[model samples]
Target: MDTSASPLSQEDFEEIARAAARTNESVRLEFLDGKIREKAVPDGYHGRIIEWLTKVCLQARPELWLYGDQGLHVEAYRRGNARPDGCLARSGAFEGAGEWASTEDVEMVVEVTSRDRDTNQRDRVDKSAAYAAAAIPVYLLVDRGNQSVKVHSEPEGGRYAKVNEVAFGKSVSLPEPVGFELDTAPLLGWVG
Candidate 1:
């Protein structure tokens, strides 16, 4: 309910997010600092990046599913649920069609940074460590404000060993859970 609590109850935040996600038409909800926040999707810029990512990944790996602005909960950490801009997950016989991704289910997570440096920092710093701790490989940050993208990989003991930053005109590829690459020029073009 408040933003000052530690290890906030997932049930509380999840219920709030679930309600907001169902009713709010323009924004998606996620919990941070024990409070639920709504995030607006930038259609031309951020949405385009999600579209391109989905198109490319689905074309190469038809069995894999790509989702944008979807909620993922790492129950083990009581971090509540986080809504990444885009995410990739491999399919399996045991996985269902409408289930949330478990720690082992997610492959890659991407976040497109807005003008807010706080958001950029949160995505790049806090969630980066959270993903590593959850053992999710390949965390990508699309930083439109700086005309750059950052790729984090090689997770070892709750942190990444390498972080590769690519500029707007450059191309970058993910290293694990499936090697996927993209050109940054097209994705960052809509920023302006």
Candidate 2:
């Protein structure tokens, strides 16, 4: 795929996304690496996993909040737009921002894989690159397909320098900026 030449410009994509949102509330669109893709409307288990993470984050860091399905401007020069499953930042970080908020205040971004064909490319690969390029401190991916959690950190030159993976039952430490240890044991129940 030639990422350099996208079919729709950034502005065009944003307008289409807004229209899609207004017309069909369930349809979510994302633009990454010069391609437009539909983000799957999460299922029951997916919602539960996000809810579980929200509780843990609130308990560990009362000062921060995890905003669900928050739209964000990502990738180099904010060229890509993504709606992360959870975006962790100081409370009210995006108070006045519109549908697509800058990644400046985002400490960490999380993606819980949906049961769809695009899961592997969208969540595991493209999103990681986009968040890292936008310089988000952490990118936590709960990959249901692999039954594992992948923590990508240390962004440098548009990519994460470190990526650590652990199975569903294991505990993983989400690094600094979003300092906390995640107990992923409950994730076993959330996957099909």
Candidate 3:
């Protein structure tokens, strides 16, 4: 759970995305096959989920490196890149100079649902597909809107074939990339 308060500035990669996305709006842009997807700033609940998920990630043994706002490359999926709300990767995966991590560098990706249909759709469908397409072992979706946590696994044909969904008070197990039994009970109060 090594977190940072480093100010968010437009790094070279972001600059390239800005130029590539062809927009000046203050929205997060994801590049995929020369097309850009816009993601608005998350609201309070979404932000809190990032903090909470990071906390859970850090508690796991053999501590993997955690990231809150880092972008992961899914170039296998038409040169795509996604910034999950929280992510865990094997240590030293980012040793060299690189703004984005390749799919293989990541263990799992987390996405907290934002308050909108578009964001919900992207988190559940688009991003999931991209992650699966890139063969990321785990994809966790925190649906504050639905009051549940959905864990997708067994990537196959651009989608995860296995899924385990549970409500806030229940628990979900994250395998492989993250071998942890994440308790969602604490989220009940905040999620409500």
1 against 3, candidate with superior TM-score: 1
Candidate 1, residues 5-115: lDDT per residue as tens digits?
A: 555577767666667667876657666534565565565667777887788888867888777665677554337467788778765522563434565667888888765
Collision count for each candidate, in order: 0, 0, 0
Off by over 4 Å in 3: 1-16, 19-26, 32-34
* Candidate no. 3 TM-score: 0.82
In order of appearance, the predictions have TM-scores of: 0.83, 0.95, 0.82
Ranking by lDDT: 2, 3, 1
Model 3 deviation from native, Cα RMSD in Å: 7.8
Tell me how far candidate 2 lies from the true structure as C-alpha RMSD in angstroms: 1.8
Q: Say which candidate scores most in TM-score.
A: 2
What are the lDDT scores of the predictions, listed in order? Answer: 0.70, 0.90, 0.75
Better of 1 and 2 by lDDT: 2
Q: Give the clashing pairs for model 3.
A: none
Steric clash pairs (candidate 2): none
Name the top lDDT candidate. 2
